[model samples]
Target chain A: MKIMHCPLNGPRNISEFAYGGQVEVMPDPHQCSDKDWASYVFYEKNAIGVVKEWWQHSPSSYWFIAERHNASDDILRTYDPSELFSERVDFTTGENEP
Target chain B: MTTGLVSPKRCADSHGDRHNDGLKLHDLSLATRSGVRGVKASEWLIAQSLHQELKTHELQPPELQPNTLVELPGSRLLMALSTREFWLLEPETEAQASPIPSGHCAPGVWPLYNQNSHAWLVLSGEPRAEMMAKLCGVDLRIEAFPVGTVAQTQMALASVVIAHHLWRDEAVFSLFVDQSLADFAWEALQDAMEEFNSVQ
Candidate 1:
């Protein structure tokens, strides 16, 4: 098998993961209702492209938000979920919760 | 310390009957002796010579993908592409003779426990894959999981290691998990399996 060096974890088996869909689309809180928000949270399109998704490192307790091409299954980039959340909300806040 | 063969006190026939009927409880006894001895956990790294009498079959390891099985010569096999790691098996009698390897054998550096405490459910028949898909999240397609492959994942919320032992025109999959979860896992499997009349 061809081993591709993943920028985040280096050479790891691609099989140990589930491709979660593309990134970049926000929930659009301005136009979306609570029902829309809830649906967005639970439902998945399982789409293919430049999408953002959550990856659970089962063996390790690490979670990453990654950007990748859906068709070719090539990961473009990845970042710690905490880092992404920190950018949008206060480190300690009402909704964010410590 | 006792000398010679240390046999645990065997319960009466009444207890044996209860155990056979799935009424009695059995503990995970590492002291349960098998005819063949096990290699020490410390000796995992040292590759011992193959037995002179037994035939050895070397198979090319499958590519790094999900639902892959690697068959060994005898009825034994290894499920290598599982999330947890490898699942080892052998014939019921010879299983005791198989040596347990130690050290970092598979990816993720997960330790391979002897797992003698677990019970196994060996399922066969035409609709085995269909029954599995009801409880597991992984795809159970024959194309996705060719014969001689294994999958280590959760089934019915319990951690399980499964392997497909291929035969001519038929496939058999073995399910191994903690003995504590045996009843729960077995019930869930039976519930799923009951949907198809073909499963008996």
Candidate 2:
């Protein structure tokens, strides 16, 4: 069985992980066009080269990021999301508007 | 504090041979356990513990690292699931009070419903790791997962937190799983332990 290294729990069976879609910049829901919002939620780059993606360790329910090659199916490196996200994102919505 | 709590695994107490080299299983669901989680959970717990120590004039417990278990006063076990999540376990003590609802215990620390949401099971014996191999993927041998080690992994297709620590000087594996799956996990463990039953 294949093994995948988790940012929290070390290497575990591939079965213990669920592949989340590739990491992408989100368009502001209230500021961006409807088309842009839909594309951001439904679409992926799906390129052939190495890309960053989100992965969850089912047992611990921990989510982290992983760099992997699409064609070779090789995991380049894995790390905690804190490395990329330094601050929390706050969305200004109609209900919370001052 | 006595809440007259009952364990989900009724057969746990009746089972298990605690003698050295004998495979045993005990159900500790009725034991006292509580948890906290949040970015400031660790800091808050440490502060609270220190406050209690001062009030009682007792020594405070040591610092805990991720995936590690530390012994505390009154036979309590402090297990760190992550830097921000921790479980305080009193395996020998029965539940006295009702579970606290989910809410802020401190500024950024929130209480967990683990006392009510999870069942506790403990396994002991010389070949405990071998028995676990039948149901789990992690290496649980004492050398690999030494005493005081904690692992959050899957056993018998169910999520479980396994803590290896010394109980009364004897090594044991303490498992925590969802209360709803207590019987299933217990039965699965019993089945894997059948071969060692004769050794007891």
Candidate 3:
């Protein structure tokens, strides 16, 4: 059986979890242009390598992040959102465009 | 105060089904239950001296380990759902008393949620785990899920909060589920238990 190690619940059947999509650091709407804001809402990268994304354990209703490779769909690891940051901070995107 | 909210329609009493005593399902409709959640929940407990053992000065206070329940020698049971979350189950014999302050509120602090609308069910018997295997993905074997272990997980395609306790040799599992989906959950659980009943 496929298992996803919940930071709280330990290794559990992946069925107990729901994919919560990618965790993107939102840009400040006041600083971004209409086009950037629209793209942020509409566009999602179909990138192949490792991706950090949100996942929820339905039983506990706890949300956390899982690092996985897109091509393989193999989850590298899962950790609580608190482990990364207690509060939100911007992820540094390579592009200067906010 | 919240406990006298509503009288539950006991599914087992209504169904009147005959089952082997070795494995039986019961509707715990009469159980008085409540939810405690918020950032300062643990703090409030400590301040009130409800559960001072949970006091932590760490930046990331550890969660109350899963599958555990808090009880004094003769006090009510408190299931720790997480670090700042709990489910308090009151006895049916006693009038529901507010454990926290009447207006247990503060600006952006520990807020209380009354969970009186949910349905409580109990599945107890020697074959309880065998029956649960059909519905849940979690391991319910006694060694893995010892008494006092609580888990909030999926059961019978519905969200459920479960606590394992033993009544002598019989394994008792308590379930709390959303009231809106209680009937659906009950039917699904009954189906899970039927095959086991037949086999035994």
Candidate 4:
């Protein structure tokens, strides 16, 4: 069985993980067009080489980032989301802005 | 101690009744357990421990590393799943009558409904790890998992948290699974334990 290393739980059977889609930054709803927002929500680059994606360890319900090669299906590196998001990000619309 | 909440496995008339000479499984669904998680959970738990020590004049609990558990006074155990998550387990004690409301236990520390969300099962035997190997992919032998180890992994295709610890002077595996899947997990464990029933 294929194995995937979880940032929190260590190496575990691939069956224990669910592949979340590619990580993407959210566009400000107040600034971006609806179509652009929709694209951000539902679209993926689906590139060939190494890509960063979100993966969840089902048992612990922990989500982390994994750099994997789509073509080879090899996980190059796995790390906690904290590595990328050091602090909370709050989004604001034109109406909510102070 | 008893809680108004009943375990999902409470309907089983034979819960905790089955036993084998070598391998035995006891349903500890009624035990007392609670959890807390957040960025400040570690410090919060340490502070709670110190407060308890000051009140009771008992030794303070030890600092727990991730994936390790430490025994505390009154037969309680403090298990750390991660630096931000910790479970307080008391297998021998039934839940208290007072309800534990769901909310923040302290600033940056949120309470978990483990007592209501999961069922507890304790497995003890000579070949306990060998039996667990049938369903779990991780190496769970004593050498690899040793006492005080906590593994949040899958078993029998179900999410389970396995804590290897000394209970009543004997090593045992304390498994916590989703409450809804309690029966299924119990059956799966029983099937794997069948072979060992005749070993001794």
Candidate 5:
């Protein structure tokens, strides 16, 4: 079984995680045209180079960013969402209630 | 307490139900479990003075010690499930029925949820380590996962929060599965153990 190193939980089996979609900033709704908004929602560059994307550790429901090469499927690096922000785990999905 | 699925009515001790080699499987449903969950929850627990109170008396709940399963003086078991979460097992003073006694919890620190989230189970016996090997990938051997070690991991196809605890000098593995999948997980566990019993 392939293992992915979780920044917080150490190396874990790939089965323990889910691939979150490509990480791209949402276009500014007020400034972007409707056509641009539509493209942003449905498109992915799918560039052959490395791109940052979200991956969730399902057991803990913790979200983290993974930089991977699209063409090679190589994970260049993985880290917690907090590394790039002040918030800890992304609470956006709200599946886990406090 | 005399309530819920794990209530006194449906709960039972090991019931002398030992596997072929004297392995004990007990219903932990009656044990009061509270989720001290969310990221940075240990800090919130510290702020509430529960950690201090436990520490002041030198009663180290499993999380505080480097060991995998240390029991407290009051038998309050703390299983730090993740970097940001923990589940307290056998809580001596469970107050989830009432408010958190104002001034105990501050805004945004980390909120505490009642007992609606998890279903509890315990795997106790001499062969538990061998049995656990068949169920999940994370190493449960004493040297690797130790006593105080806790984690949110996949077990028998369920996302479970597991904490190793010691009861009566015997190794005990406490499982906290999401309430929704509790029954399925428990059933899977039984089947997993059945094969071992038949073989032995």
Candidate 6:
């Protein structure tokens, strides 16, 4: 159990956390149905290697980010959960996009 | 025999109030302070320098690894792992409201807060594990959990701190949780132990 420092809540209690996979799997709301939304929200596949996972700070009222190596069971990095939700923008056109 | 009278020894009332004689149950009220505090190596060095009084054989120092359990003298068990680590399971006497001695750390440097908000439930008898498991999610297997071990986890929808202590006559556990959740946890355990004829 390697210690993963969380940016939002420094030094979180590890056991109170549940890993959600690959940080890059953003569902397309336009194409996704209610069932698809439900599955995306509830179900998860425990994949190995560079998987983006969701974690809940159940004890603390804070959301944060973490990176872990599933194959070796090692924690790579952690950051604030809001970091992933930052608004994306087209820097070339100076237009804000998500 | 023809009168169908039951023997006095066989009567239920003759057994007395069994629950009344059991361990006195108290309503624990306290708050939970959560966060990790670092322990300086200097403190460990000082504790080691104290007059070594070896009474009972302490378990061999567990390999320096994550989540390893270390049993110290005076029934003290320490959980070594993570930056915010080391849980001391002192005897019931140690939980009383008293200032812990200083010198392990520089005077007034290390602040130790009173963790009384942790409601402690002392469970004894043979069915302790069974009763506890019904409320907690952790596996309390004997092989996984030996005597003089401590675990921090959730129980009955509440965060719990549990330590197992083995005695010659009976086995026991010291369970702690937030004071606000005490009644909820107590009721949950009692309801789970209903089939076992729990006493107090």
Residue pairs with colliding backbones in model 3 are: B67-B148, B67-B149, B67-B150
Which candidate ranks first by DockQ, i.e. highest? 2
Backbone clashes (count) for model 5:
6
Q: Tell me the interface RMSD of model 1, in angstroms.
A: 7.7
Q: Write the residue-wise lDDT of candidate 1 on B53-157 in tens digits.
A: 122343332232334555545444444432323334443322233455554433323344444556666555556676678877555678876666665556776
lDDT of 3 by residue, B63-91 (tens): 45644775432335667777767666663
iRMS of each prediction: 7.7, 0.8, 1.7, 0.9, 3.3, 6.8
TM-score (chain B) for model 6? 0.59
Over 4 Å off, model 5: A28-41, A87-98, B1-21, B38-40, B54-70, B91-105, B110-114, B198-200
lDDT of 4 by residue, B15-55 (tens): 23444347767788888898899988877866875456433
Instruction: Give each model a TM-score.
Output: 0.45, 0.88, 0.79, 0.87, 0.77, 0.50
Residues B57-142, model 2: lDDT tens digits: 34233356678887776777888888888889987789767646755988888998998889998887668898899999999987
Clashing pairs in 4: none
lDDT of 6 by residue, A6-89 (tens): 553345346666565455555665556878867777766666686566676553333456677779867777776556776543
Instruction: State which candidate, 2 or 3, has the greater TM-score.
Output: 2
Q: Could you arrange the candidates by TM-score from highest to lowest?
A: 2, 4, 3, 5, 6, 1
- Worst lDDT 10-window in candidate 3 chain B: B53-62
RMSD (CA, Å), each prediction: 13.5, 3.6, 6.1, 4.3, 5.6, 14.0
Per model, how much of the real contact set is kept? 0.00, 0.57, 0.67, 0.81, 0.67, 0.00
Model 6: CA > 4 A from native: A1-98, B1-16, B19-36, B39-84, B92-114, B167-169, B198-200
Evaluated at residue A50, the lDDT of candidate 2 is 96
State the DockQ of every prediction.
0.05, 0.73, 0.54, 0.72, 0.45, 0.06
Candidate 2 chain A weakest ten by summed lDDT: A87-96
Q: Rate the local accuracy (lDDT) of all candidates.
A: 0.49, 0.81, 0.69, 0.82, 0.66, 0.50
C-alpha lDDT of residue B76 in model 3: 53
Candidate 6 - CAPRI tier?
Answer: incorrect
For candidate 3, what is the DockQ?
A: 0.54
